[model samples]
Target: MKRKLLGVLLALALVTGLAPTVQAKTVPAGQTVGTVLFYVTDKAGERVLVSQVPVSEMVSDLKAGKVDNTLHNYSILDRYVTTVHQEAKGFTIPEFVTYAKEKSAQAALRAMELTFAGQDAIRLWEIDQTGFDDLDTYTCDELYGVARYNYPLLYKYWDYRTQEYADPDGKLTRDQAVSEILKSAEPEVPLLSVLAFSQRYMITDGKYGTGDYNMESLWYTSGLMDSERTPRFMKPMTKEDLTGKASTAADSRYWVATLLLNMKDAPEVTALGAVGVPSAVMTEDGANYYVRFSCPTQGAAIYYNHNLISPSYTPTSRYTGDAVVIPKTNFPGGTVTMTCRAVKDGWTDAGVQTLTLTSSGAEKGWISPYKDVTAGVWSYEAVGYVTQNKIMGGTAKTDFSPNAPMTRAALALALYHMAGSPKVSSGTGFADVPSGASYASAVAWASQNGVVNGTASGGFSPEAGITREQLAAMFYRYAKNVAKTDLTVSRDLSVYTDYADAGSWAKEGLSWAVGAGLVNGTSATELSPKGPATRAQTAAMLQRLGLFVG
Candidate 1:
């Protein structure tokens, strides 16, 4: 094969070096006969990907460093195959195999069968490699391109003792027949098998069938096997016997895997409910790990979210563990806080800050949202207003270090206070809370009031760190309980331009805060909700919400 390839290369070189003149020039289209490129479709006869041409355009794109084409192609092919497999349930193995293979083949074939400049040179390689096959490669004027065709055969490997499909031919067992078809249908070109199979013969055919047989199940299960294991594109599926959905697999899968791994073993739960925690960490160290910062050449905009526990991409690390990072760009200078730590542990340290944004376009007041107030009485009022008024104060000194984190206990107390500190029963002891804690009665009261529930384990980490989103959620609960009364969450703490962030969590609270002229952002777009609510800042927010009017 190597020698043949070398000889072909030499022949082509010789032709390039003027051999055509001595041989009477039989070749048409000069030396570009076999050179071809075109669009390729999926087995469903849909053109999912295309090869760019016009050498100039190709070169230009290459120089510009664009790679969207290859990525888009892979994405389309993956979706097409996955869709076919999922829809192939309840069909006979042979019928399913034939349909899937034909679709795959047609997609590749259509690409090669395209025409360009009145020339078509692509020829398909025979499976035997003995000679070229006309059926493999062809030209399509409609698509204006040429393509190489290949297809994959699908088969079932399960020993059907309980359920058996009718096999009339009697030439081969149902499993044997499917296996034989797969063995014989190997293609010489790239063949994307729609229904990927396991080595032990479990066919991934059923829809919503939880277990390892679902195509992506193997990947997810294997991803958990070895922490260091990295998956390649087409690695064969293994670890099948160990992976059929033990509990509800859907609960464990992320977005991508959930879309791919449709099975019966998946969780019956359909909706994802957001449970709020106070002071959710965004990143680790003094870097932008979870949050995204957008700075324009002249202006600045920051968009933040509390879903920073895991992200698609890791940001630059500065300190370690959920640290704030400010991106560097060409712009006017300003000062930003670099570090702010809670007096207690568990709660993440506010790592770093960027320089304060300049007073170029808009001007707003400045205040540290995470200010410490353990030292001063005036600071305590602000701290208490921020903590006790909102639903984030520690239910007890030991339950939640209001200064430490606003734990679940602290959240309940803050929420109760946010709801006018409603009174309720002090009955059955909570299995989670200690018997003699200050927040214990409040936690029980909060639960009785239908505000917050403890973990399934019946224990709430009274001293655990709280995230900003969680605090928002607590405020939300308080607002709902209080019959939509307005509470000032922030005012005069102008650090944002957008009011949307302020209105995001507790709409009623934000509305009240805004309507009462107590809470306003930096401008109209800068509502840094994810920014920590310091003792002073919280006090200011409560004052705006009408909490400490007395």
Candidate 2:
């Protein structure tokens, strides 16, 4: 059983690896601004930048670099660089670069706009390009361009008030220059806000690409990836994007979205119920132990580890059912704790449950080979014991015929085995008991031992069906003759409604059986002693008589 369970877990693991792969991060379509993106090439290199470029172009540039190893920097006008360096796996860089650039640019731009307002602001732009061209050597080409273009207006105004090419005591800082460039290069189309960023490159179908940029995708990817690999860029979604179509499992953004939507409403396992007796007598058939449990919501399935006592058991999607049957052999006679949980797609686990099981050691002998005697039947244990003890054999190799009536010959043979199959003192005692008959010696031994007697006309009716009262009388005689125990008068027979109808010869045995808790009346008041005994009833009675004791 343990080996079989292990095989199933390995199979599930293989299947999971073959299932569809989902991207860890996704980017929405269209232009985005004020968003910090990480451009990375494996563990060797990465760059942090705030870009106003369309998401599609950004992905294309990154992939091109990944292909050729010569990824060029994007146009500086549309992007603000925070830092440039290689980052090893599992390391995270600071996010202050984009923030600093945005703040510095906004401050410088605001200062310039206020200083050159009214009629002078128009005059401030009249300066020529000669003096500004030299400023190119002092900065990056993109930054120089922005500063150069704005330098003319500032120079003309300063000259009108102080007669100089620049402020001698107040040179523009780098932040101020970058700020001017940003203000002048602002795109005509409004930049979309960035909602989220990916910490790792998105790979799909053996090809790398950026997927949809939305909160659903953002949350989905976030839920799927570990904290170290989670995307860094995130922006709130607009009201319109919030009302977009729902995502499915096939979508990269689905899992995270589903997790967020259903987390709180996930089902919980309310209780676990074991189906039968906690302990069972181990047999050759290897009867299984069972458990039943339920969850609060529909579509929920139960998962459990087969080994109830192993501390290292890893829970997988191998076993699924509201009720599970575990082989008794796998768990020997001791306590075993079965761990279980309720799970479903799109919901959090309901948490684990533990069920304890107890089992007895294997019993010896030839157990019935019948398949019809299933576990949990009332007479199952008794039948197993009786068959294994060799007191009686099944009607055929594969059937016990437990519901069939027990004949006098069968009872005689069963008792004969119980008494160790002793040899008969004489050939045959009754006229009907023949020497060649299968139960001939059994009847002879039973008669000589005073366990049974012949009917009228000195004939042993071996083929006749034995009645409940007659069976009790035979058991009482055997107990006295073989077991050396006399019947005790414990309970009053008056409690039975049919007690008065019981024959004088059967009263003592019936009283003994009822007192020992070996037999019961058909109802609270009726003994029904004259009724024929079925195979199942006989097995039950034999078990109560301690046929398989010890």
Candidate 3:
């Protein structure tokens, strides 16, 4: 066929000639920040990755004259990271693959099919070779413009009619050289397939996209591969199921979201309650991996008691909610599969997705409202104790937001839940803790019982995050006033290097907490009294306070 850019590559070798120096291009819209690794062949015949020339700095590397994309000899891969569980029961492959297939599947494919292919990538490299100072000096569009304006010199300097260059060497013909260079551009196995397949199958589909090689236009993906890494997009579905051979694939940001479930919350006993909505339903901005994905991102509705793992379609379930509940009777062996579909309003729903919940560390099998509270995590058991006993609940439907700062409102809520959500007979004098607010009764009960007090200006900074010493003081009062526990516990705060940083009033509480094994310094020597306390830290302290189960 037409090795169109091949001649341009040959012509550019001797050109000190007429390519215009173009001004810089503005940054493209909706560009995402991510890593794309490039590998070059080493003297050992292995493709050794050039460390700094790869991820995190490639764009800067190009701009700094540290790397070259002047030719297509480099094999590059765009990476998207995900985690996996060692056990087959919690494997994450299905979850990630489901994301790619359901969320933004064919939409990106269609748009890219019309404009992107392997030769487009080749032309990008060829344009860079024009030697107007490489990508360091000009943008991809500027390079393309330079080529568009100057590269047709191929017609003037070379003879396509004679099947040879105007200055061809006797040692090589045009066809032989074109074939060799094209072969070199075909990198390793999978990469070769990507390029050749694009040429043989998809070259004529579309061209003239935005011309921004810095992540505009379209890019190629390996396509969805089944078990053997065979392209599932290739070959027609057989008399049975098949890939149904076809053309090029697009890399999309429209992949579906997934649930990062709390394994400890898996059911074991009589009845596991409806857990919580997923905290990690999707990736990046919570709705899209790509900024252009379907908007007003939505959650999914789970259909459980279906008893099937991978159903052909959405099932008619006995129940539907944000989370799944399986009784010990239905989940006899500690494993139950449920189906889910996205509740996306204007977009396509991810049809019958199968998810499984399994039994965790012990027989009590407490199902939590927080997906962040999982087995093996540092505060797992502590979070379990508080959540199981109703001392704490999620800040959101399914998220504990463990790393988030612990606010006074959350503290009040937890202490109230610990008090069995008692009805408040009187009001808290603090103006901020309104009578109608959710934590009103908790603050009221705690205030009446001397478990807490109003801050300066007669107001509670309910939304403000608390320092570590403040957490110690409030829980200490709860221990003394509400729980009416012994107040004799004490420790030498001087042992900690930062002990003097604690406020005088909080020293008693901090000492008591340290003595009672309810709180530990952030490090062995530093008691970060003024440092912000996170919800996770509070959970651990609460668990050790003898306020709930050990």
Model 2: lDDT to the true structure: 0.41
Return the top candidate by TM-score: 2
Off by over 4 Å in 3: 1-362, 547-550
For each candidate in turn, give its C-alpha RMSD to the true structure in angstroms.
23.6, 31.4, 22.0
lDDT of 2 by residue, 42-83 (tens): 111211111111222222323333112221111111001111
Residue 482 CA displacement from its true place in model 3, Å: 1.3
lDDT of 1 by residue, 322-427 (tens): 1233332212133322211111001111211222222232212123244333433344444544544354543344332233433556556655565567566674
Tell me the deviation in Å of residue 412 in model 3: 1.7
Candidate 2's C-alpha runs over 4 A off are 1-367, 547-550
Candidates in order, TM-scores: namely 0.24, 0.36, 0.35
Ranked by lDDT from best down, the candidates are: 2, 3, 1
lDDT of 3 at 170: 45
Whole-model Cα lDDT of every candidate shown, in order: 0.29, 0.41, 0.39
Residue-level lDDT of model 3, residues 1-550, one tens digit each, is 1222221112322322322233322221222212111112222322221110111222232234433323111111111110000000111122222221222212221121111112211111111011112222222222232211111112221222232333233455654543433332321111111111111111111211222111111112222211111011111111111011111121111111111111112211111112133211211211112100111222222232233332222232312111132345534454545443322111223333445544333333456667876756776666776777788888788888889998988887888787678777888888887789988888888788777766666788889898888888987898787877645445555545689888998998887666445676776457899999889888877766643211
TM match of model 1 to true structure = 0.24
